[model samples]
Target: MATEAKKSGGIVETIKTVVYALLIAGIFRSLFFQPFWIPSGSMKDTLLIGDFLFVNKMTYGYSYASCPSIRIASLGINIDAKDICGIFDGDNKRLFGSEPERGDVVVFRHPVTGYDFIKRLIGLPGDRVQLKDGVVFINDEPVQLEDAGVFEEAAGPQGPQGLRPRCENGPVGDGGLCVKSRKIETLPGGVSHSILNISEQATDNTGIYTVPEGHFFFLGDNRDNSTDSRVPQAARGVGFVPYENLIGRADRIMFSSAGRSMFAFWTWRSDRYFKAIE
Candidate 1:
């Protein structure tokens, strides 16, 4: 009987240890980092579908966008689950960290949908932004662009079918899409990143837009395919994302897979493992 009791106590202790470990891991994930996997080709070429990565939670410090009031944060509560941002409703000064820089890949809450969306930061508060003939113009002058050649991609089971920005012209392999004209765009501070150019797309041109204070403008790397700041929120576009909506920057790709299931070891993208998001 005593041996059975001892065994039961050990099992209870093991369960408690696991529960404590999970709680600690939850706190670490909430405070230090956030793991996410790319589900769409929106940030493609830079972050492909199935690319798993971590967002530094502290990168922008504690903000209403991150959690509930700093008060609850101190109480060890989950901010996002509590809908603190929606309840408080306003701009929040970052408790720490720096502002988003040009050409940064940022993760943020979609203003209208509340869904987590990732895009490249383009215009800062008060910066003039425009797109003309498939080129991005900031402060009246076009951001520099140079030809970078083709970017090809195979469609995933989850990806939309047929020709898209990632697979612009036509078939690549058995069923892949390829873009023959990709351009490397250099931001003002010399931050360079590649952008796709589909001259036929309507978003390729736009009137000059002055970014409002306390907000930032964003664009997708797959320029012609993304519905970002250029689109209105009512129509499912992000529009001008408020400062409070800022989440964190994605720093690296932890892993990637090309298959439908994440556990499919045969579909692991070996080349993209541990790749940096540039």
Candidate 2:
């Protein structure tokens, strides 16, 4: 009888140990490094639909659904199950001191549907941003373009696709798609990054927009195909993203896959893994 009691006690202890280990891992994954999957081509060339990315949660701070930001005490504190559940249940708000900078690629909760999107910052507070003739202008200066030649074609299980074509003829006069060269342009704050041009004609162009305080203007790398701040807020597009909506800056591309096919697993491009985002 004594031996049986000892054996039962040992089994219970082992179970507790396993449970605690899993809890710690889950907390780390959620608060430090969370995995995100790309689901659209809005950020194409820079990001793809089948790409798997690791979003550094600590880059900003603890985001609690839709409520304002809060302090995270430690990694293993099991204090608020309500807060964890609130991620999908409540509103989104940012913690204090969580500000985004110009040229940071950020993932944020879309103001319209509360869905998440990753986009590049173009205009900051009190800056005048406009899109004229398919070129982005900040503070009345045209964004400089540097031709990078053709991007390497990406291959998938189904077949292969060419790089995002460049647009050189300015915006099309008739509102059709045009591909031109890609280039890196410096913003007013000396923040430089690459952008794609599709023809010289501007379609969803906007006039001088003084980005209001506590808001930001974002545009997709795939400028012509993206529905971003250029569209009015009433049209279900982002007019300006509040600081609270920001999740974190996209630090790097963890991995990438090609094609728009459903079976993306077999099409993974092993060479693209861990490529740093430029």
Candidate 3:
């Protein structure tokens, strides 16, 4: 009887340890840094699919969007940040918030869908932004772009999503080289980054979009492939994201994998480990 009682107490203690660990992890994720996995090529050479980074939550302070959204399909555990922290939402204000600078890579919640999206901040509130012939213009001044050669990757399926990359030199067979034109885009205030181009698309040329006050305009580095501020939310694009929807800034990549599973040691991208995000 005593042996059974000891075993029961041990089990209870183990359960308590697990619960405490979970609570600590939850608090850590909610307040300081949130893990973000790059699932798409929208950011391209700047941030490839399978790049894992921690969003610096404190950079923009706290808001309802800063709360982590947990989704485990296998476990059927789907929890949105709104479900946990919705009580703190609706004001469109952030606590101890700081303004995000242009050219900074950010992760924010989609205003309508509540899903997270990462993009480079291209336009601030009240900025006039436009794209003409695949070039970005801020307040009618064209941004500086210099050809940076071409970016190439395998034509086969990439990452866990098995998504094929759209290439400028397409019609590539599996295991062949998929290529896109690369350029060094220098935004206003001297922030420069790499941008990829496949070809001229409808989004390449657009009328001036006057970003409304209290909202920001963002665009992906992969200009031709992104569905960003150029398209409206109604059209399934991430329209001018609200200030409160901003979650955090992504500073550096923590880990990266090119395979279907992160645990595939052979597929780990050693060069990308602890790499800084530009």
Per-prediction TM-score to the true structure, in the order listed: 0.85, 0.70, 0.98
Which is superior by TM-score, 1 or 3?
Answer: 3
Candidate 1 TM-score over all chains jointly: 0.85
Cα lDDT listed for each candidate: 0.77, 0.66, 0.93
lDDT of 3 by residue, 1-278 (tens): 99999999999999999999999999999999999888899999999988889999999889999889998999999999999999989888899999999999999999889989999999999899999999999998999999999999999888888999999996788999999999999999999999999988899999999999889999999999887999999999999998999999999998898998777878889899899988
Ranked by TM-score, the better of candidates 1 and 2 is 1
Please rank every candidate by TM-score, starting with the best: 3, 1, 2
In the predicted model 3, the residue pairs found to clash are none
Evaluated against the true structure, the overall lDDT of model 1 is 0.77
44-154 in candidate 1: lDDT tens per residue? 678877788998878777565665222245568543523744554564466675788888899888887667899999999999999988888999989999988877665
Model 3: lowest-lDDT 10 consecutive positions: 259-268
Question: How would you encode candidate 2's per-residue C-alpha lDDT over 57-159 as one tens digit per residue?
Answer: 6666655532322334566544432355455433444554366777777787677666677888988888889887777888888887667654333232222
Compare the candidates by lDDT and give the number of the best one.
3
Highest TM-score against the true fold, candidate = 3
TM-score of 3: 0.98
Clashes of 2: 19
